[model samples]
Target: MPRIFTAIEIPADVAQTLTFLRGGLPGARWIDPENYHITLRFIGDVDVHVAHDVASMLDSVNRAPFDLRLDGVASFGGRKPRSVFANVAPSQALTDLQAEHERMMQRVGLEPEGRKYTPHVTLARLRDSSSRQVADYLSERGSFRSAPFRVERFVLYSSRASTGGGPYIVEEAYPLAAIPAKRAI
Candidate 1:
């Protein structure tokens, strides 16, 4: 089984900017900058056949490339502080692309994602970090922002079953265009 998801890779410059926020927070297992990505859809654990179907289905997603910015920082577990992430500035293009992925996955017989989409890139996995610790971390870096970057493509990624903030492998790649190319232009 492969734990799969579809995501847009963060550019190297942006990842370098994100690296500055890595240390200081207690119990924070910071994710490597190389693994930084804005997940479009999480397919979760699936068997080989379903994974193959997911890859084939995703190739049909036809959405244009668009700009994205990372703005602000936040914690997921409100009080308990399970993880920390950089919030993705919401854009209609990102939302539509994500929804299209959702629709495609369902068409391939995968379960719909239950959580409402809140676009973000996980920066760290929080374990024993306290509420005060989390709050303090957020406060210091709350206004963090990155230069906007173009999302020219999205990828099918695989990761081991573990507390995420990954070691992700790009299983396949798919390009984006202003419109789906019709029979090779």
Candidate 2:
């Protein structure tokens, strides 16, 4: 059984910027560029049957593609700084999409994680780090932001079992609709 989740991938240009942000802070273990993603929902280790069920449920999902702006920087975990993240410019569309995903997963009998959905792309994980350095790091990048990127699809990924986070494998995918045709043909 592989730990799995659904997420939207950031484009290469945006990912290039996130990749550059890696390795700057002391005591931070930066995520590999490939692992940077905005997770919609996490469905932990599950049997093959569950994976297929989740995929089937996801296929019934309906949502238009949306633009997401990467705005601001933030950190999680007090004192020790467990994670560094790129925050999204709040969007109602993103919220609705996530909520739909949660509901769909729940209807499939999956145990939903009891946490509010906070939209973010995790950049790094900190260990053995003091708040002082973490605070400074946040202050330094507080104004940092990235241009909006189109979120055209979401995927069901199976995460490799590891203490360091993941080596996610795409198990299924649902592509969102293209932007409406301007002055339809």
Candidate 3:
């Protein structure tokens, strides 16, 4: 059984920018640039039948393509930081898309996601790094930002069941609705 999830693939140029934030902090296992993505929903290992249900259900999602921007850098877990990430600037379109995924998963018999959704791209996983170390790192590089990137589609990705930061395979992709061109008066 493959561990599956839905996410937006980071463009190469954006990923390259994120790579600059690597190193500097000890005990940080930096994620490979190619693996960078903004996860929409995390669906843990499920049976082949359930996976099929998920794939088919995702096809029904109708949303327009939207632009996303990386605004800053932040860390999760507060006092005992677990991972560092590039914060995604808040967008209602992104939130609505994610909410739809959550609802769809629950309709497929998966339980509700307990944590509130906070969209971000994981940069590194901290192992034994202290609070001071993480704070100092954030203090230096927390102002990181990236130019807005157009999100044309979302994908269903599969990964080996292990510690997160992926070697993800895109099993399928669902394109969002394209914006219509204005007609001449």
Candidate with best lDDT: 3
Expressed as tens digits, the lDDT of each residue in 64-174 for candidate 1 is 889999999998987788889999998999999999999999998888899999999889998899999989888999899999999999999999998777789999999
Q: Which stretches of candidate 1 lie over 4 Å from their true place?
A: 180-185
User: Relative to the unseen true structure, what is the C-alpha lDDT of residue 103 in candidate 1, on a scale of 0 to 100?
Assistant: 91
Estimate, for each residue in 92-166, the C-alpha lDDT of model 3 and write its tens digit. 999999999999999999999999999999999999988899999999999999999999999999999878788
lDDT of each candidate versus the true structure: 0.91, 0.84, 0.94
Considering TM-score, which of the candidate structures 2 and 3 is the better prediction for this target? 3
Which residue pairs show backbone clashes in model 1? none
Provide the global lDDT of candidate 1 against the true structure.
0.91
Residue by residue across 1-185, what tens digits does model 2's lDDT show? 86889998888899898876776688888888787789999888888888889888888776788899988888888766888899989999889889988988888798776998899999888887788887888888877789888888999888788876467778888998744555956
Q: Kindly give the stretch of ten consecutive residues in candidate 1 with the minimal lDDT sum.
A: 176-185
Residue 40 lDDT in candidate 2: 93
Q: Relative to the unseen true structure, what is the C-alpha lDDT of residue 182 in candidate 1, on a scale of 0 to 100? A: 66
